[model samples]
Target: MIAEHAVPTSVELLRLDADSPRTAEVRRKVVGLRLAPGQQRFSGEAAHTLPRADTDPNRVPFAVLYRQTPVGFGIIDQRGILDEITAAPAEAVLLRAFYLDPEWQGRGIGRTACLALDPLVRSVRPEANEVVLTVNEANPAAVRAYRSGGFTATGERYLGGDAGPQLVMRRPVPYEGGAGDG
Candidate 1:
């Protein structure tokens, strides 16, 4: 059972290690991650997604931590769906398998985690200039969260998703250094 907490906590994204003890704990927590019935159609459980990410060289898995506890999961795809489903620049990275545990939802953790993705993506894929994701048309809450986190719809709909049509959204990866800072 998930512990019930009333206050929103700090959110951070940490790269996961398939063999680490901390990751093992996270894996256990993932088994209990619950999504609403409607959400089940749009996002995948981390328990299933993480194993695939572990074997894919181009995919980087991240554990979303809130108050130092694992509360969500996400993956950064280097080039998996670029031309296959969506058209994006070569420097763009795909945000996949992103979802928070239902118990942790609505506390602004998702938006905070989304805002924290830029640095994490840059750390792993320095050449990435933008982050792109496809949200099912039925998932308005997710679209709103992504928008709040700085993504904008590209007016393109992807029909390849199994659930239904999806909107392609993207946001530029913010650069840390200013002009002449190199």
Candidate 2:
């Protein structure tokens, strides 16, 4: 179970829209994260990295909101990374550019946010049976966070990482019934 805190965490993933009025605010919040070398090379800019819905039918860009405030962002894709990684199963969805504000780092928000990704992806992309990501082995804190959130290291390392070698991680998404389950 997730830890209980004085401040309740309400996190939601909203699709990134290019023309929405809140787009600018969301971009500002996400870009302000200022990811470090390894993380920066992995995430890039959420705004620049997110593909247009039309451009890629299987990619979903999201703004990670905590208690109604923009604290981070990421993308859930049915293609791309997984194709390159090869270790993850065909039913996996690749999670990319996951970032939380520095101030919100140790508050359990990141853990909760990471845990939420599986359900979030399954909800939007039912074809995905798992969520996969690569965390730099050099960043032990991140490896720990992902593990705490239910992701397991695959023992398969990606050597093309920016700052150092990256360990491939995978979290199996449980099969939740779809619309006609009733």
Candidate 3:
């Protein structure tokens, strides 16, 4: 268990599934996760998003862990899941509903978790060559965090979001055999 004031040094992404032994505990943690004030205008809470992800075959939910304790959540959407919202290419996966509990923010956990997405998505969707996401134009912190984690703005705007406009961003999924492997 993580201490209330302790900072996590590492982050890991675990697939959320009913069959896992830690499922109940992780779910409880996710249910209690809170976002900072005004953050809700940018991202969805895990508790609310989990149910939809549970029923959608194209959306794979993951629990973000720190020292084996759940502290955040994210979802990777397969090609067809966000076709209308993202207009991403066939080889891209959508990163959605990503958030770290308010208490866990600013500790580098979110950045580490974002960096881990490539391998996680590659393991599940081998054909995915890039990861795409939309960050609210008003949420500069999130945009910086995503940028620090290797995503770059695609110069496109998504106006379909509930909270005004969003900036589309993307990053290449690193090759399994390392750079220039292709």
Q: Which 10-residue window in model 1 sums to the lowest lDDT?
A: 1-10
Q: TM-score for every candidate vs. truth?
A: 0.87, 0.78, 0.88
Local accuracy of candidate 3 as per-residue lDDT tens digits, 65-133: 988888899889885335754454677889999999887787778877887887789976887778889
Model 3 off-target regions past 4 Å? Answer: 1-9, 80-88, 180-182
Candidate 2: minimum summed lDDT over ten consecutive residues — where?
Answer: 1-10
Q: Model 2 TM-score?
A: 0.78
| TM-score between model 1 and native | 0.87
For candidate 2, list the clashing residue pairs, or say none: none
Local accuracy of candidate 1 as per-residue lDDT tens digits, 1-182: 32333334467787875578887777777656766667888988887888898888989888888878888888999977777544545778899999888777877788778878878888778877788899999899899989977789989888889899999998778666742211
2 or 3, greater by lDDT: 3
Best candidate according to TM-score: 3
Q: Rank the candidates by lDDT, best first.
A: 3, 1, 2
lDDT of 2 by residue, 1-182 (tens): 33444333687776664667787677667655555444665456555665453277777777778877877777787786687675545678888777776656666777778777756787667767778888887778888878877889877888876677889888877677543211
Q: Root-mean-square deviation of each candidate, in angstroms?
A: 3.8, 4.5, 3.3
- What global local distance difference test value does model 1 have? 0.80
Q: Give the alpha-carbon lDDT of every model.
A: 0.80, 0.71, 0.82
